[model samples]
Target: MGLQNITGLFYPSQTLGGPHIDIEDIITSQNVISRVMHSYLGILVPLGLLAGVICVAILIRNKVKHQTLENLDLHLLALVATDITIVFYSFTSKTRPDYLEVSNLSCGVLSWFFNTSYFFSQYLLVLMILILLILDDSKTSQSHLRYVFLTLTLSIVMSVVNVSLLGTYDNLHNITYCQLDPLNARPEYDFTKFFAGFCVPSLVLLIFVILIIIRAREVEMSEKLQAHGVVLCHVPIMFICRLFYNIMLIRRTGLKINAFYMSPREELVLNIAELAVFSGSCIGLIITLALHKPCRQGLKKSLQFLINKCRGKETSNSVI
Candidate 1:
């Protein structure tokens, strides 16, 4: 019998005794790693983002100066600022909970912060590439603005739906910590809402990005300035990293209630996915710096100036 085989197999089903692990163990392991990775970025990426802001400033200095930035550039900067702030507050800052002092309403606020920035950044990037395509006299049926509007509407609805989680906001256990869903939570956490609010739209955006990249390469235009290709390359890699992290978090949840070990291959996949995302951000910076000359020169000058200022400050400190 199948049961006989399982029972009789090699070591036998019976065991002496060992410590049992639950979902908490799994979630804890995953979150510890996730928090560590996020913390690492909290320290390093702010500098990178500052560099990016400087580059953006230089790009617009001749035309608009610091008073204003090109719409795309401004959106990109805002996206970076929000994302960096979220990660820093969520993972790095010792006093991060201070920001939540007013209320526990911030239960998942950081996730929303990152989500909004990520969604906006993606839409803005796509819009930028769309503009590039249009300015080149390319033909298009649906307008970029139309799609942008649609993306916004859908994203807003989805976000609102997700935020409708009807449970007591437990500050200690919320925001970046994995825990069992508050089962009794009302109509908000329904399966339909979960799919509509997150999965479906995300998949749509993912496909749209892929299509843009392919179309960009195929379409004939004056200099073949295909920026969409860069976005295509960027999103998948970022998605992989976040996806890996999510998988680990999910896996840990399952482990909390069950006893099991993941295959070595699965573990490898998760690590590779997470690292790929971190590296993807660096890749994006490089691509932007390379493709946009104004940005590159601006960033270089900013870094040099910052370095000099640091040296000057250190010299003064030593003298004191």
Candidate 2:
């Protein structure tokens, strides 16, 4: 197959089929799918970015005013920042009209950024759970900072490996397609990403959550424990949001290996899964604002302050 043919197969709207398929019907379906995908991205990406920025601002303000920030707060800030980057990158690259013309360097860098940010966010949650498990007396801000640094460093290394293996340049076609490399070329990369990035962290999170719940039942729940409860709520939300994306990845890999064509229906499902992944980040921020009293209070105060300032300006103008 030519490069164009191969690239076409990767897209949902350009699947190969038997002669029985109607060409006009396929064109109509493709147009519909494109509209749906664009519409979804238009709404979700902006809303997600806005919510992420607000959440970050609220967290930082609370930290500044109180002069006492917990380790969980620090991790939450990092996660929000990471998610913002992910959303922004997704919006720019996926929505671009000529993504196929991306230069080799740009492709590698974008892949690296996406993988590193995503992996860092996932493992940061694991560390947050671990911090919750540790005793209050033993915890220190410096230690938590070190953990954050360590997780970032590890994520960078893993992303380097991912880019080296999966991201490739096509000299003949004079184009670089990010994440378009054949999975069978280096099957280990996909397996490693799936296991290290998703499966292992998921397993660890499950065990820690169960242990935390058992401990909560055994002892009297304090304010600190209540914060831990928020983490518990976050765990399930993250899992559900990420689950579909992972499934889509697995399915895509399977279809590629078997040389099977992807139907429009399957492609629609994958597109929805992609949206779910970004939406997960937004939902996580909402959960923190709703369940964490400090953040919720901080947001309320900020809104009230803005409202009062606007009202003051209006009154002064009316008097003039």
Candidate 3:
């Protein structure tokens, strides 16, 4: 019903009162964390956007030349699109200057877009793994588009539910933040999101990764299977990048409900977690380009093409 009621449900002992901490201490810690977060985002967001554009260009060129895309390529393209969307949204939303006003409506909209893209990407990876495991190339190539549509539909629904539980507000210090809106901050929603969004999906992904590994061991790995293996790398990367951020969310929820003072150390950890979350896409893209053979081949071909074109221009200028 409200913050007071939600706090009572989880932290009954602290309901009476929380220990007093100096307001200046809290503000100082917040400011330090904010600077660190902004610095990390400043580096990561632009790098991610640039990498995403290059990857998309490569994929699009391949599609045009071949007149068709493989199932793996389609999935990778979708994943790249979502990752770029997440990075672009972060640039627009999280990196805003402190002096700018952020209305609650804008905050909610940004949060919704970020969460939608993130969840969509995660589930798309899951579907990619499933298709690799269960479907033959012929079947998957024919049906991947339909499956993508289905995953997008599901992601939209899940994101709507996720955003419904959150609301944005400005603190006494005029700092804008998004959190579980007082009216919707129930223990049920908190626990549900923790488990459903993080714990359960993570566990499921782990299981899928294990099964794929086992299957790979059972037979000779072909080029197709090797492509799947490259995609499989994303599962562990996702887990590592997201684990800290989810922990930070759980801790923040507890502190908010109990009205507990967040120490500078905790604030530092929270900023680090936020950094890890944003880094996931960047790291994933790097891994894809480094290990995915087709991407490597594409890069080499593009480089060679550029070199020849530049050489041709030089020859013509010399003749002139």
Candidate 4:
């Protein structure tokens, strides 16, 4: 369907290069829209890495202090790990101007990792929601272990299959980046992609939201406005951004074939959608830091410790 095609949500085509791409045009002829997309990616890469680093530090400190993983922290750490991979792949793809020009095993593998990490992140969130719904604090640690094992095992298997079936970037789609070809996509491809990538997670998330509302109504749980709910609720924003981006891609392709055929107006709208995807990903981590009380408290301690260390150093210097 035209709508599906616009989403740019499916796997890459198995075929290699279609038409001869002019590298010069890609580099020199990028309009303002393409440049803005490039800029968004450039910023997102670093922002994602910073989020990962902050989370890692907090996780480690908590582990050392408590001598065991806390329920919320363990799940959050899993998310941070996935966020690192997603960020790394985004950084690599965005930083290299020649990413599309190169077709090597490493490049293909990186593409595979990017897709896998995204899927794993979504799956992990679904798992976390289930944990919150099903288990109390006592069983959460055990559940987290099982969740991690399952998510990792499934992520590896599905990513390998996705790459094997779909292949990798065939050509430089545009100045901003290249991606899987929608033209060569099969019907089965869309089903598998939609099921794993969108459908299951969305359904689970909706159910999770409904459950939260019901629980709030039944029991006036004052703690409902706390960190966990805030962090979990923020996930839907990412999903909505991704959904819109794919829809726009469908719209763009319906209008014309590729970036080469994109009008300035169409290109601008496409870039705007692209920015939403980037922003949504970054916002997840930001929300974690902002709303997750444990992470916030750890950050506060870490900051105060640094300040004390600085003061001690200054005192020693004066004494000397």
Candidate 5:
């Protein structure tokens, strides 16, 4: 079969046999998906870069100053790094208007990298919170190292399975981005992706969150500390965002809507869900910055140092 004919099988029932949409019309019309992705990248790319750079600098300074590295510190660094990687990958995957369309192999490769990075970030958050729930006396470097190792291993496996079986790696036509074929994909595969991508991670996080809550009450940490833990961990917030996004996907695929059949209004809602998925990754870093004092102070000093150096250079230039 021709490549175009083979590609046709990936769309939902509504679009396949229904009214045809001109490829040019799809691209040039008021495309909400493209706009949404553009806006998401515009905000998230810069934010992730700043947070990742500052966090890395903070981790480096701690090592240089011979400060003890806590488990939370290590987790924050990993999360920041993952968030930045996803942002850059997203930028690379965004559709270019004039560039020749990408080949299926290239699309699959992009999809694999993007999905794996995203899953790693989510699963890492679950692992971090689980570690936090462990008794402080029992937690140690060797143990934390093991947990990190296992999390990455599992995330890589799941990403590969989802990309390979759950759906074919193909560009979503409207967004022109590589993703598991969403509309025409098998419901079984959609369920697989949903269960693995969001459901499992969210479940693990919720269990740990509950344990933390129980421990907070048992320890009688001040109400302030309990509230602080909830805020800093930010598991509930992340879970909610993922839950909403997963629901939207389930509904769309469950209802078997054609990929191209979304009205502008439905497309807007889908765009929001896509944004939620991206935003979910950013929350962990934001919480780390907000709650981790060493990280916050280090980032502040790092920024100020850069600012001062710039001023020094400008002053010397003026004098000369």
Candidate 6:
């Protein structure tokens, strides 16, 4: 898709070694690129699905046999699992056979799961980090309860607002299955609504995450575990990704294809955001599981068993 988007965006006039592709004639070129990219996706789908299955097996086993995860963190795991599913499905998504168009429902469902998990996970993570960062207080349980409720309430409100403001999940880019509906690109677009609903909230979360990181660093721990660093890394990744994505979303009116369509500056930010998003979930899992001895050991063992089973199945299939 990135390659195709680039080919479309940079339509040079004359060919030095190849054909001329001037930026003026974009629509025709874009259609050509889109068709080629769509065909390429047919080959990419099988590999993507295989990888998704492996990732799902790992997450499922980790969820089932996790011994050291705090009871409160189950929701966190659920969010993480859902994220994997969302991305995996989105990556392997295909077009319908009849009209050569992707199913809006599949794309929408994946997008919904991804976005909903994102907000709620951050909501939970921020609360957890706050509790850990701040000094001891007597009403920890009550305060924690309130925090959970507040986060849930906020999630619900934001979701409703998103549906109302951004239109339903049906609004998606045809080529990139994972892209978000830009607020500015909506039917009755309002810049204020866009900034307030998505942009401002992300900025606020970033500020809070920074403060938490600073406070956490200042305090000395009895155990001196490096887990704090791992946790801190997770929040910043989310903040950075949200910030990068939202900003580019406003800065560009063209399209969100790939690195090619972007200005040099936009390109840099896009790369960073993509990396942060990709690393956010898996790295967080690695950190959380690796930080605790029991979880680290248990997950490693479970993964080994799963891998062995997959290999056995592959062998059986090959024989048959």
> Largest TM-score belongs to which candidate?
2
Tens-digit lDDT string for candidate 6 (1-320): 12112123321211111233334353344354345435435543344344334444554565567633332344344445544543453333233111122334344444445556556666666665554555333454445556667876776566545445443334344332224332123432223334644566566566766665555445353222244454455566566655665565555534423323443334334333433444455445545555544445655787899999999999999999
Better of 4 and 6 by lDDT: 4
**Clash pairs detected, candidate 6:** 11-21, 11-22, 12-21, 12-22
Per-candidate local distance difference test: 0.44, 0.68, 0.66, 0.60, 0.62, 0.46
Clashes of each: 3, 0, 0, 5, 0, 4
What ranges in model 1 sit over 4 Å off?
A: 1-19, 22-43, 59-75, 89-104, 125-157, 169-202, 209-230, 249-287, 301-320
User: Highest lDDT, which number?
Assistant: 2
lDDT by residue for model 3 (1-320), tens? 12223242222111222354454555565566577667757776667777677778888888899988888888898998887776665444253212123444555566667677877888888888777776457665558888898999888888778766653322212223332222124444456556756787787787876776677765544444766766888888888888887787788678767766555456556656756766888777777776766777887888899999999999999999
Q: Report the candidate with higher TM-score, 1 versus 2.
A: 2
Worst 10-residue lDDT window for candidate 6 reads 9-18
Q: Over the stretch 1-320, how does candidate 4's per-residue lDDT look in tens digits?
A: 01122324321121122244343334332445456657666676566667668877888788998888887788888877776665554444342222243333344455467667767888888777766655456675777688788987887777666565442234323222343323233334444555677677888888986786667544333353353674466567768977876666556445443333443344345546655665666767766776777777888888999999999999999999
Question: Model 5, 119-224: lDDT tens per residue?
Answer: 8878888876655566442567667767777888888898778667634444333232234333334566567778988888888877877777677765544443
Cα lDDT tens digits for candidate 2, 226-252: 656667777887888888778877787
The segments of candidate 6 whose C-alpha lies over 4 angstroms from its true place after superposition are: 1-72, 92-113, 135-150, 167-179, 182-184, 187-227, 253-279, 301-320
Q: By TM-score, how accurate is candidate 2?
A: 0.84
User: For each candidate, what TM-score against the reference?
Assistant: 0.54, 0.84, 0.80, 0.74, 0.76, 0.54
Candidate 4 ranges with C-alpha deviation above 4 Å: 1-29, 37-43, 95-99, 104-108, 167-177, 180-191, 218-227, 249-275, 318-320
Q: Which scores greater on TM-score, model 5 or model 6? A: 5
Range of the 10 consecutive residues with the lowest summed lDDT in candidate 5:
5-14
Give the Cα error of residue 117 in candidate 2, in Å.
Answer: 0.9
